[model samples]
Target chain A: MLSMVKECRRTKVFKPVLDHIPYAKFIGMGCEQFGDEYIFTLPSNDNNLGNPTLPAIHGGVLGGFLENSAIIHLLLKLDTPRLPKTIDFSIDYLRAGRHKDTFAICEITRQGRRAANVSMYAWQTKQSEPTAVARAHFLLEST
Target chain B: MKENNEALADFCQRGMADIKHSEVLGIETVSASNESITLKLPYSLNLVGDMETGALHGGAIFTLADQTSGFAVFSHLHPQIRIAPTLDLRIDHMRKSTKGMDLFCTARCYRYTDNIAFTRAVLYENDIDNPVAHAVGSFMFLETVKDQGWLK
Candidate 1:
């Protein structure tokens, strides 16, 4: 697992895929491997703010981040190199995402031949207390 | 009805301008009424998600739908309410959007109470009958906190 993570980074496999995604770059989302785990980061930017008065991150941005995180997680974990297509995404806003660096962690709940389900949690300060949680279903191409 | 629509359009435009992300995505008010409101998101290279297909990112589509839903709530409440924060949102991607084509979203606030508002939105490129995405969202009205100047 560690070797695979290193290979993905050293070979410039995932970086290019992420770089090519203009929306991911526009929001300044980055992924890093830590001890065989991948963590997605979204740096706070004024252009990503949804509610200026409350200075909160947009709900859609959060949704996007979570969805992308799930896709990237699948890329890293699954053997298939193809990008997963999102089918449906459901998100619950537990608390306001403040203007701060946010982090997301994804767990694959179930992986089938044709589809996979991923659950994601995003938080600012504490992982235990997530600002938002989401579940996404993606259609995977058979290799 | 025309005068009312014009007034709602002005209000929607102002609301869109106040959002930094909406400005970044170039979301504009297409039409506005108390019954429903439509918004447009112009296509840009910066909004692409799929490098192979050159399709617009699902996140960008979600943002447009989310904003349109919020605006629908605003149009429904009008002068009675000033702010409604999103409580939760769910989006279903029906199909991949065509590249270089602008996306449009129309949303309606179907139900509301003093504290919460419910809305649904459809996103499309050309035909409303064939939407690329659909969204349902609930928003929280801060009327109870109005005494603390929270609504101001």
Candidate 2:
């Protein structure tokens, strides 16, 4: 039991790093882990809006949200929180992100010794019909 | 042509500045032309990714690249169309950013079909010749705003 507590304490590295990221806090990004899945949440806020005409959220914000989800997932999943550095990121925007609470989920497709790949999906209304899909590779430095 | 270009440059600058997310991220337009534009993002703790290394977050950098890509699309095919939403984007982060150094991105739309426009962009700091990241993307064109005089 003590070993499990120690392991959980070690994984809490994402807290400080995320707290320092003003952009994440400003956008109100939160996360919850359910079993093997890490779900990201972005609260509805005016500052996140990009197009006043359509009242759509900024594309940058969406990309950022997905990428951040990747980081948080990797940090929590791995035993050591050595801070994941992004090597590449790709995103597909399927539909406009309307003003509302957004949610995203990340899956580590492959985690090799040096590099890890993550796939992220974000949606507002329906999970099946995602607003955007993003994939990213990160160089892990946990050693 | 000159009138169209001038009007376009004005519209691009004002509209980009007015975007709330851009304001929060401290994204500023360095210059804009009929074909492309350069944007600047100053270094701030707000964008930090690794508190230990003081490296800027990849998401912040991606935001700059994504926004620059959008501007490239606008300069290429907007006004003619009301808006161009991103259809796809791919970015390669070549290296870690220098601590406390501002980043800049210059993107240009190199191709356009009836409904799709393609763009390529580079993100760098200090020396523009050495880029820290590269991106390629496409945008989808939408309706023509009458007031935009896109048809004119």
Top candidate (TM-score): 1
Instruction: Kindly report the TM-score of the first chain in candidate 2.
Output: 0.86
**Residue-by-residue lDDT tens digits, candidate 1, B1-152:** 53348878887788777788988889999999888999999999898888778889888998898889988998866755557778888999999999899999999999988788999999999999999999999998765443323223
Model 2, global lDDT: 0.80
Report the first chain's TM-score for all candidates: 0.90, 0.86
Query: For all the models shown, what interface RMSD does each have?
Result: 2.4, 2.5
Fnat value of model 1: 0.80
TM-score for candidate 2 = 0.88
Candidate 1 chain B superposition, TM-score: 0.90
Question: Model 1 off-target regions past 4 Å?
Answer: A1-14, B1-4, B143-152
Clashing pairs in 1: none
Can you list each candidate's DockQ?
Answer: 0.64, 0.61
Task: List candidate 2 segments past 4 Å from native.
Answer: A1-17, B1-8, B77-81, B143-152
Q: Name the DockQ score for candidate 2.
A: 0.61
